[model samples]
Target: MDRTRTRTRYFTPSEVAAHNTTSDLWVSFLGKVFDLSPLVACFQGDPLLLPITECAGSDISSWFDPRTRDIRRFVDPQTNCIRYYTPRGRFIHTPPSGPRSDWDNDVGEPWWRNLQYQVGLLSEKTRWIRIVNTLTSQEQLQEVCSEETMEEILQRYLCYNSHARSYTWKFDGAILDMSATLMENGVPDDDQELDQLGLDRDTFIPAVLLHFNDDLTEG
Candidate 1:
């Protein structure tokens, strides 16, 4: 999912929610999404995997300390030593309590820290937009991450228009700032207001028209 070289990949919470099965598990923790299906398969039948499986398609940011970017810990009363406080039951990646000789020491990096398991960043916000091609009179309705810059959005639109980079992006007759995110470019996100007013979003999604620059750039 993070394969696009020119674009930064982002996933909405609902998008991550769709992969909530054991065979297609996805979880977001500390603002990053992880595809943990391989880990689930590797630790199949282990009770420790329960916490992760049960909370699939949800944020687990609470499990970590924001400052340290590590698991939250508490002082164990009996041992008087700090221990990871996983109220939902320990998961497969949790460090062993009171290290035992049997616990394998060669497990490599934890799933949360492994780049192989990371898919994308969790979108802070998402908005609907339409890309209208002036030359072809074509229109494509898109649900886009609000954090995307005009250039990144162009990268996303390449599937529809191979020469997207050769076009000028304009919203309301003003050339867009390619370096800034949609919000920073002054495209307001009014989804929340639309929801409050009970208005259908399809009719209100902003449109950005593309005018061909005729550079004849080749892929």
Candidate 2:
């Protein structure tokens, strides 16, 4: 574990209480489970932020790549709706109603319309953008931590904002893995306590354990 990397800043209890982040979004667990800090900081965005440019003159199909395998969609912030495009150059204005039970689940136009209705209640400025690369197979990290390496992960402490929110935290992956093995022997995380109390002990203990383990492994 890299001590320097794990030292990334986190939100304090006061900070967390003050934040009004979206209900659907979640912070990356100290870079443990998910890392979205990178995307949040520097994703090629502004496509969704812009109010749906006059829909009449808008060529929505131009925003999508039909060759991509996954369901390519973006939120129309103006309408507060998520939009998808088809290979035939058509726009889908709705999303699937329930959880996706199958990998190949296909949503019809009716579902798309209903999705639009739901998104309309969300913030008008924030939207999810769909990235596409149809030709070569590429691994775009869906879960990001920082804009660094893919391995040797560390978790992030995210700050939430309610009015402008998306499906998840918007960040890139970092170079540290919180679960990596530590090099030190006989040192347990419980031995150390935070500078403050009242935080979740279970979560804090595991965090300490993981950090200590990484420190040992690196040494």
- For residue 12, give model 2's deviation from the true position in Å: 16
Q: Pick the candidate with the highest TM-score.
A: 1
Q: Which structure among the candidates has the greatest lDDT?
A: 1
| Residues 36-97, model 2: lDDT tens digits | 22222332243431222123211233443455523467766767566664434332233343
Candidate 1 C-alpha lDDT tens digits along 1-219: 332455548887888999999999999988799999999999899999999999898889999899887789999998888988899987876876787886786878877788899998988888889998888889998877877777778877899989888888887777888877777777778889998999997878888888888722321
TM-score of 1: 0.74
Global lDDT scores for all candidate models: 0.84, 0.28
State every prediction's TM-score relative to the real structure. 0.74, 0.15
CA shift at 39, candidate 2, in angstroms?
Answer: 15
Instruction: Compute the lDDT of residue 30 as modeled in candidate 2.
Output: 16
Clashes of each: 0, 37
